[model samples]
Target: MSDAATPELRRLTTYPVKSLDPQDHDSVAVEHGTLAGDREYAMVAKPPDADHDPTTASVGGQGEYVNGKRTAAVHRLRSSLDREAGVLTLREEGGDETRTFSLDDPDALNDYLSDYFDEPVSVRHEPRGGYPDDREFDGPTLVSTATLREVASWFDMTLDSARRRFRANLEVGGVPAFWEDRLFADHGEAVAFRIGDVELLGCNPCRRCVVPSRDPDTGEETPGFRETFLRERERTLPEWVDSDRFEGNFRLMVNTRISESEWGQRLSVGDGVELLGTRQL
Candidate 1:
């Protein structure tokens, strides 16, 4: 049996494709500054050229990615990856039809997505580190399970909904609410932490976007989500949390970065977490 007082990795989730649903993992290898296969594929918007075929589109382009922050309709689409079979399954929220495509077949995948979003979009793959929100802090995000429960209780939402809303890659158990905040230090400094043999530098709290304010499945905007969350977050703010990192209350989870020395380290679900110390950022 696990000790409730001992901090340990409770869950590991990765989004093979950005803005899609998350996939759980029991173990994952750390590489290129992030977990392998995390955000390895992303849907990229295509340029507004009438003659340009989105099906033939390449990953390289000036267009931005189609993500939940930019497109609410993304919530209506569900996706799952079968890594061994190298296949991707997709389905609409309300539709009964399901579609499956080979991971190597970007043309077909792009075609389906283009129609779903009613715009030109293509799937882009970058095995090296993939696409992370913070360039410097591209390591997997960390959050305490207690924090998720507390946040869910705030809005009368479920733990799964809170997890989807935050989209953290790592979930730690046996810690108090907002305990992950201790992993970061004041501005210009960082906290060094370890999960089993893997060492990561805690950078700062992840600033949330509008995606968290919408329903995870329907994209319906929650009335006063931010307003109510801010109030609750501020009321429960711990003294150990660094105020320097809190530009506002719309932040949760600790963003981290991996050093080259920690590359290839494997993180597991039951790995114990230890806060080693602090380092200059």
Candidate 2:
């Protein structure tokens, strides 16, 4: 389909952590593009597990390595948050036993985490649910399969390949290709979301990091395909798209927030969402 045509939205998913397995659901409560359980828990490295100094480090500050680059070790341990139990479980890839720690119970969470890594590792609850309050931290991000297919088609790859690179909470199908890049707003009252303290900004195309190279399913490392996608973007898309060059194929929607107060109160999985009109600036 042409980019100008109204694209259909299909499929939605949420990853509770950076590289942990994604949970597929028919519908989800949205608090700024965050599906109910997305990114609620994260695992970090400490003294023995990592060489970095933890004394001066803030909780979750160890996510980024030296510069903006993230460490490979972050991708090595798989973690997930159990919303019902409020526990964060971590285990080595392919390891049989999983250690569960309570996110609500800080002492137990940190103690188990600290022992597991053989270093001082702590856990923090994702305030605003999974949404972060800091502007520096992009709050409540959303992406669509239409956008994924657009980038994948440009690179002569499959939609599945693009999805692996652009991990998101929801993937609406039936939306026209690349329609997500232009979705500034939604007019439907049925589809409302709100986040406390966290402002929702439509993300610009997220720069792909090496994390995509690691197979979320297998935990095996693969060569980065982001460079190929970038090369194709420069060749096919107009210069405007290239003006803000990023590694991945996803685009950002800016300056918008959903009415999330009624989300869990009214909406549930399998609830039909209709797109009335785009939100205007």
Candidate 3:
């Protein structure tokens, strides 16, 4: 809450493989919360369930997979997304080899993934031919250190610990908590990114999931630390809707037409960012 702690810039990271793990980088390309190499591959059900509709299967959100529930198990398989080569690679932990597929060929990707998972897992393209129908993002998803600090303070933990729980693409320094709701970066110039053409919405304060409780490095679950922390500190916030559902830390810029290619063309980590003001929606 002090001005002295606000930083003008911050580090950015992307998890090329969803749920598998996040890879941090000094700077990355951001377009609608997706870094170039993030989440290009997902494990999908090979055959739809009795009432399931593959065509309309939801991509991101809670419990759209087996048993209609989302858990760390879905991401247990290790995968990586490579942008330059337009490829999605997969390998089992401690396995001898890796499997690679081109996002350009959906059929081949689907076949390979299905066989690999011993189920009907498919590779979904990123920026998937101009964003899929299920995408909940409106503009770019940004986070500031101030916001992280506030969330940490609420949870009585260090920022490093919180960062592991709420994974954000851009972790900027020198801005107020939740400033991304009102700021935008234009052509690498920091500008107030308000929700005009773009819808500015905060993610439900993220419900602490088992993923954070499970050490990504060790693959072991700690005893009730995350859930206990949430109960004691973050449970009262507006974003914390209830015991089972907490608001997501990942915010969204909705109803905007910021194209991924256009956004990619303009922004990069370390680019100058400007804060416009509080949103007026």
- Candidate with best TM-score: 1
Candidate numbers, best TM-score first, in rank order:
1, 2, 3
TM-score of each: 0.92, 0.62, 0.60
Give per-residue CA lDDT, model 3, range 51-91, as digits (tens). 43333655543213321134444434566666678777767
Span of 10 residues, lowest total lDDT, candidate 2: 189-198
Q: Is candidate 2 or candidate 3 better by TM-score?
A: 2
lDDT of 2 by residue, 1-281 (tens): 24444332245566675445556666556554345666655444443235433223534745321111244444446666666777667777778988886666667766765664466655444534552322332434455566667766655657886675556554545555444444332222112222222223343444445655555444456554556655665554433333232334433322234444434432233333343442332
**Candidate 2: misplaced stretches above 4 Å?**
1-9, 31-34, 44-69, 106-119, 131-140, 146-164, 184-203, 217-221, 238-256, 259-281
Can you rank all candidates by lDDT, best first?
A: 1, 2, 3
Task: Name the TM-score of candidate 2.
Answer: 0.62
- On TM-score, the stronger of 1 and 3 is 1
**By lDDT, is 1 or 3 better?**
1
lDDT of each: 0.87, 0.48, 0.48
